[model samples]
Target: MPPIAILVALADPTRCRLIELLQGGPQPVHVLAAAFRISRPAISRHLRVLKQSGLISEKKFGRENRYALHPGKLAPVQRWLAGLLPAARITEAPAVVIPAVEQPLPKARRIPKPAATPVILVPALAAEAAAPAPAKPAVSQMGFDF
Candidate 1:
């Protein structure tokens, strides 16, 4: 909705390229990935980010998943651009001023940081010293020990 948010969404290079590709028409994930040098999984991840950002939308049709540009999600972006630069400056113009389809925004993902080393208050020797030793079993003075 905000200009900064839109800019942040499009900041990723992969996402920018994805938007460019979707401009052509709706395409399957495999087709989109095959067009790029990166692996399909990588492309899928990029698409996931783009989808989360509301730049794209996906649908399952039969055996394939199709993705297309969602202009509604990009309204804030176009509006932001329109403010900074005049509409006439935008070279590529589609029939609709902006597609009204809803763009799926990506979820807020948390990236886990590396685990820190645990600090032990007491030394191993000190711990052993603090522990009680097991008592020896008492046996009768007999030839066979119990």
Candidate 2:
């Protein structure tokens, strides 16, 4: 199959999971659908896409159809990825440098003296004038204060 179609087939989450499931071996449509919460038709649709892309192949068995992964069809993709593997497998760690920074806080300014205000001494008021009266006691009969 074309590389683009293969990639498109694997792009979907459902199809990717289906591929993972198929890796164990071939599976019938109902068996694959049982693995997902979605309707059986939805699973079939994903399988159809995978089969059309040549990422998978379907076989006839009595009355049922079984789908299996076609790993051979992924040769181009595997080779392309193999080419990138050399760069991905690092032998030496890359260097990292952090530059030093010097920050100076602003100096405090001298505050000017304020003009003085005159002060007079007075005796504090008696407690009764400053304190509020206590609330009246609540009485309940059917008449109640909350």
Candidate 3:
């Protein structure tokens, strides 16, 4: 798979969420859309991106299309990240052993003193209301008074 294409596809939040959902099994666009607030068309667009990136596989099931994760495409990404791990790197020499020092650690001043925060207490509202319930909208007496 094209690593850059896969990275670009997975970079989107919705695409990543869709990829997570696909892990359980293949799902049609409608089913995927139900898991999110976005419209079906938007979900389809995301699927297309994943497909173009070779990160997902799509199959036509009946009249609907089902999408599944193409995990192999992510192998490159995994390998790239794995290479960054210290343990994964090869060394010409054996592991070094450093002696432990008995020196006391420097004191930690973790929390700074609380600065004075100004408190503005709002005064209580007046008991009297602004006005009555809009004067009952001035009902028309054209027909008849109740």
Candidate 4:
């Protein structure tokens, strides 16, 4: 499995940026801390996490502690990711085309529809139809009927 510690160490934006800084070559803690707006102690804490993950190494030069990147430690992570992808085939199979055979569709039989009958209205029903309809209730934008 890919090193969970490496993933956890790189989870923080501060730690990721520290890795980027170390990529330039070994640098003293003071120089690395100067690259960020955070406190020196906070930078030291991030470096410690990276060291614990085996992603970086520290060397003492006089009173200063210089950190360097161990990029080879990331191979397990790369291998784990590559394993998730499907393998490519060296040779592809040739395509074969089959000729199409078309057949005529059968004719559909039609049935005649019955004619519509006329409607006659009585005088009382005619008067009611001539009368105006009642006004609908007012509706608000919220769908409430007033």
| Highest TM-score against the true fold, candidate | 4
Of 1 and 3, which scores higher on lDDT?
A: 3
lDDT tens readout by residue for model 1, 107-141: 89999998999856567677887789999897776
TM-score of 4: 0.57
TM-score of 3: 0.56
- List, residue by residue over 1-146, the lDDT tens digit for candidate 2: 33677887888888888887887788899988877777998999899999999989999999999998887787777666657685664342333322223356578999989999885544475545667988999666563224
Q: Using TM-score as the measure, name the better of candidate 1 and candidate 2.
A: 2
TM-scores for candidates 1 onward, in order: 0.54, 0.55, 0.56, 0.57
Candidate 4 local Cα displacement, residue 36, angstroms: 0.8
How do these models rank on TM-score, best leading?
4, 3, 2, 1
Best model per lDDT: 4
Residue-by-residue lDDT tens digits, candidate 3, 38-138: 68888888899899989899999899999988766877777766676757853334323232234665788889889999865444533334335555667
Model 2, residue 116: C-alpha shift (Å): 72
Q: How does residue 50 of candidate 2 score in lDDT? A: 96
RMSD each, Å: 20.6, 26.9, 20.7, 25.8
Query: Residue-wise lDDT of candidate 4 within 1-146, one digit each (tens)?
Result: 66788888888988888887776789999888877777998999899999999999999998988999897897776666667654832332333323223455568889888899887889889988888999999657563234
Which candidate do you rate higher for TM-score, 2 or 4?
4
The residue-level lDDT of candidate 1 at 4 comes to 64
